[model samples]
Target: MERQADWRQEKAQALARARVVVIKVGSAVLTDAQGLSTPVLESLARQMAALRTAPDGHERRLVLVSSGAVAAGRAVLRAHGHSGETSGLSARQAAAAVGQGQLMRAWDEVFRAYDFPTSQVLLTRDDLRARQRFLNARNTFAELMDWGVLPIVNENDTVSVSELKFGDNDCLASLLVNLIGADLYINLTSAPGVYAANPQEVPDAGILECVEDVAGLDLGRMCGGKTSVGTGGMYSKLQAARRAAQLGVPTLILPGREADVLARAFGGEAVGTWVRPEEHAIPRRKFWLAYQSDPAGTVLVD
Candidate 1:
């Protein structure tokens, strides 16, 4: 395929082989400044439920890596009169405690509507970075898949120290794509995708159609919309999608607010910027090192 090829031409071919897909939902998409958008979450869940009932649905499995507990939790805390003067760590942990229940309730309501069982799996960075923990996490998801249950994962923010946190689900999304060996990774965000200039800064910023390499891209100039409940911006998402693509897992960076975008992606339509997977899945050790290898410290290449 040409570097700039309209992926639509290959949608059928792509979807045919896409058996496992990972979706990353950022707080911007799942919550308003105050808290969770029950209706939007319901709508998204309905879409996913609809997909599961599709003819080929049984052949495919979908995993959701969601971020919103902190955002939602903060709202709950504020509603309960928690002081805004709390430390960042205190606020996040408090919010997570309050909102995790609400988040699960919303997802449960939707998934149950279709008679699908959704199980929650809270993980810390250690779960992905530690080899033994990694295998255990994978096996649990594998078992869930075997039993026809959709595994819903989120970072264990309530107890995780800062360094232990994946920081944002964008990075978690990328790492999860590798963890699950997903065929496609869909990263749903508030904005559409990567742009040459920050969309807010540049009125005419255009979404790049496909990303072949982000290592050479300028990310310093990119900033997130500063959603009240979340800390990730498109820059983190670009980092996520690029990492997933490098693992030979195709990723789509699409606007979460757009109706039916996730469904369209699964249907093999060009929904947003596409980060095509590397020509092939890199070998295990190299992929593990590059995808999951711990960096002792920052090192810039000459």
Candidate 2:
């Protein structure tokens, strides 16, 4: 029997009508120990294609923020016996050099099968932190969506200093949503959902269905970063959603092991966790201030 997502659910319909959606894919989902996973990307394209076809004027506008360039690049380097590592900055830059093209070409081939045109846009934190570059980048995204092109973004790893590449796609995803003013920010990963207890350790760990307020949850105990070739885990996903909620954008974090997970997430099948914005949603600038502000020296005025 073939598997299918029940798109008849409420969130499924809402997702179809969502004016703009930003989806982030982690390295774990897109790669194996050796490298990039072909089936994963293909499955992702299938889900996006469905939303594109949905009636009700739902013709969705989407942006995919993907991570895996370094993994892919490292794989290529390993084949040449280069060790794919460096003292500090060179290791990451080398991996990115080998992987960015590999990643983009693979995506291009799969996306082309669905006739989905994609554009590669590598970004850096500096792009978002600086007001002028940030505005330009935002305008670029808007223009791309306006023209119906899927913008596949990743950190410009090739040129970035070590340990500073968007760090992980989760943070990149959140910032992307902030930049685009997206209606929804969906993080598609390999894990099921946030569990009440660490499932691997606790045989019957409970799955958290919804998040009304993040502070209420003990997320620190959730999971760690980048289990494999990827550099993100459930922790970043939750943080992304929390930041998105504060900015008045609802977020859904779910497993992307299958193509239908996208539909499943919005369809209300309990595939992942949902975090909603508060009543008095924080303004974008304020949300950034609270969440993205630097942990620097502080002084209080009474």
Candidate 3:
């Protein structure tokens, strides 16, 4: 019990001291049968406003990685005599194209109400693959943060083919953490936190509050289920958290739909699963080589 208290306090202090944070909100938490939930966006914006102006007189910089374009597009198209189930890659791309505007507008409007300016930043894997391009992207993020602007990032799904895609927003958020050298990575999803089993399957499955060693866990047994509305599942979140951990940034997976969830977690309420960072940070060059580069050949070791 004393050890548990120590860890909880440590996590709370980390969260409180985080000056730069990357927040990724999953599609399941942002959309519903009608499409993008404006109410949810508004609620999140209110909470984020409070976060930006820290109580201790330290300002916070935030980067929002949001996923909901295709889901929102499907909802709009369905109301116009189209099926929500997109047939092929092209069909899904079309949905993303139609919905990306709506998604941005919803975010822009909500943040504007709180006097916060936002910028849309769409990226593909290829953009970061090149060294110069990677540096350029990093510089851009620096400028945005310096200007006190909220950079809303997303995969350019309309143009990103499977071969060039970032896989999901969770992966994109992980990369963003390294790009900005973020202090914390907050992943808000429909579920409260990481669970011992899929909560839907095992109704009484306990939530795992802290993940001390991400690499040692049996992720296959812990997470396999995926939500219909979001491209990422619990497995992807764990993988992303592992990546962030390697970069010396802790990750918090929390319930997105709850009011003031970010506030509560940052205030030491311990409302989610916290993945602690490794003792040492990965070197920048090595992190890029491992994550950004595509291998041309593989050597087999016996």
Candidate 4:
């Protein structure tokens, strides 16, 4: 018990000192049967605003990588009398095209209530895979952060075909962590944290509070597949966390709908599972060359 307490304190201190944080909210957390949850969004916006200007007067840079365009798109489609399952790729893409604006508009209005300005950024895999484009995107993010504008990012679903998609926003958020040199990555999802078994299937599944070595654990069996509304699942989250760990960035997987969840997590409340990173940072060039680039072929050594 004492050891757990110590770990929580350590993580809280690290989070408090982090200068830049990347927050990724999943579709399951952002949307419901009716579509976007205004209450949840408003609560999140209020907390983010408070975090920006804390009572202690310390300011932290924030980047939000959010998912829910397709869900929002579904709402738009329904409103327009296009009623059918949005499971097909084309239908999903169409939903994204129509809902992207709605998603950004909702976010903008909520943030605007707090007098905060938000910029919408849409990206595809090719955008980051290419060296020149990657640098350009990085510069844009840097400028936005410098200007104190919260940049809200989403996958360019409208133009992204199967070949171009990043698979899920979890992967995109992980890449953004390295792209922007984020100090911390927060993945807010439906569940409180990673569980020993599928919580939905098992009524009494227990949560894993702290994970020091992701490689040593079997995350595949722990995290099941996708949900009804979201593309990625717990498996993708663990994969993203592992990638961020390689970049020397710790990740926190927590419940998004919890009241004051973000603030509480940073305040050292131990509300989620913490994935610790390596002590040394991986060289930026090496990371890009290994993961981002599409190598022609591989050569084996004797």
Candidate 5:
């Protein structure tokens, strides 16, 4: 009971102190069987607009990492002979190219209703792998926040090859948290939160309210396969949360399908799983060296 109380207090404090937040909405939450879900976009936009103003009336900055361009593009191309499923990398990239514009337009229109301007920021893994490029991207994000324009970020799937692809927005969002120095990381998904076991396989599985040791969790048994509409699954979210924890940023995995979910979660309602961060943040340089940089060459010491 005392541990629960302590975590609840910490959760409230984290939410209250979060001035810059990175929210990553998975494709399952953003898309439907047809394509991009305009209704979901509108609902999320409304909630996000409300969340922009803190309880004390201070302006909060939000950076959205959205995934759905490929799904949207595939939906559109289905009429033009693109069929049941696409497996090739080129096919997926083609779909992203087609749907990128549509995705942006939908977001622009939805957010515009709230009188909020937005900027589309597409990135590739390679873009952030280099030191100068990483700094440049950070500066761009800073300027976007300064101008009060919400930066709608996505992977540059159209040009990204297998070697440089982010795989999913989950990975991208985790990286962005470190790059932007975001106070909080919110991952809105189809599920309510992380479960003790794969909920599909075990109907009795319960949600984990707070995870104090993300690294100690057995993700293999707890996660399942990717969603039909998205590249990531619970495993990816867990990995993302783990990264955020290492960076000393608290992560919330909430149900994106619930209307006003963001508002509810931010309003101190226990709506999802909260992963606590480390007591001391790992140094940025050390983190970058371990996670961001690629090995230049392989050495055969043996």
Candidate 6:
């Protein structure tokens, strides 16, 4: 029990000391059959507001990576006499175009109510692939943080094609961790944490609280696939955690719908799975180049 206590304390300290945090909210947590959950957004905004006023007198910088454009678009489409179950890339793109604005509007209203300013930042994989563009994006984020403006980042789904897409917000969140050198990466999902098996299929499945090495685990089989409304599942979250760990950024995956989830998480409560960073940390510039930068060409040398 002493060892466990030490582990818990260590995680609490890591969370408490995190000056810069990147939070990614999945579509499953943000949306339902009807539409976006105002209650959830309200709670999240409150927590974010609280985070801005740290006890240590140091201002915390936060960046939110939100996914729900497609789901939100579907609701808009349904209201316009279009089927919510619209298929095909073009149809989904159209939905994203309509929903993106609505999604931001909802976020803006919620944050504005709390007296917080938020800026929308839409990005594609291609945007971060080029060296000059990557640096430019990094500078933009720095400026936003310096100005005390919270950036709400999302994939440019409306304009991005299959080849240029980041695939899911999970990957994008991990890249953001490196992009801004965030101290912590929080992945708020529908489920509590990583499970031993599918809880739906196995009634007695257990949650793993601490994952020291995500690469050692068979996450694909353990966590399974994507959600109905979102492209990423538990497996993608684990992948994101591993990527963040590579750069010495710890990641926490927790249930977003829980009452004061963000507050409880930073308050030293062991609420979800914590992926610890590796002992040897990679240089920020090197990590960005290796992971974020797209390779021009591969030359096989003997």
Number of the top TM-score candidate: 5
- By lDDT, the best candidate is 5
Whichever of 2 and 6 has more lDDT, that candidate is 6
lDDT per residue (tens digit) for residues 1-302 in model 2? 32124323434655656778899988888888678888888888888876665556556789999988888887787778887344256777777887999999999988898888899999877777766777899899988888878999998877876434567789889988888888888888877777767665676877777666765667777654456666777777888887777676777778888658877665557678766654456677665555444456889999
Better of 3 and 5 by lDDT: 5
Writing each residue's lDDT as its tens digit, candidate 4 over 197-257 gives 8776787999889887775678766777887789999999999999888887889999999
What are the runs in model 2 whose C-alpha is more than 4 Å off?
A: 1-16, 84-88, 162-165, 288-302
- The alpha-carbon deviation from the true structure for residue 177 of candidate 3, after best TM-score superposition, in angstroms, is 0.6
CA error at residue 29 for candidate 4, angstroms:
0.9
Query: On TM-score, who's better, 4 or 6?
Result: 6
Which ten contiguous residues of candidate 2 have the minimum total lDDT?
Answer: 1-10
- Per-prediction backbone clash count: 0, 3, 0, 0, 0, 0
lDDT of each: 0.77, 0.76, 0.89, 0.88, 0.91, 0.88
* Each prediction's TM-score versus the true structure: 0.88, 0.87, 0.94, 0.93, 0.95, 0.94
State, as a TM-score between 0 and 1, how close model 5 is to the true structure. Answer: 0.95
Error of 2 at 211 (Å): 2.0
- Return model 1's CA RMSD, one decimal: 3.6
Please state the error at residue 57 of candidate 6 in Å.
1.8
Candidate 4: give its CA RMSD in angstroms.
2.9
lDDT per residue, candidate 3, 1-302, as tens digits?
A: 13344667768778878899999999999999999999999999999988997768899999999999999898889889986568478988899998999999999999998899999999999988888999999999989989989999999999998888999999999988888889899999998899988666688999899998887788888886778888889999999999999988889999999988988887778688999887788986788899998788889999
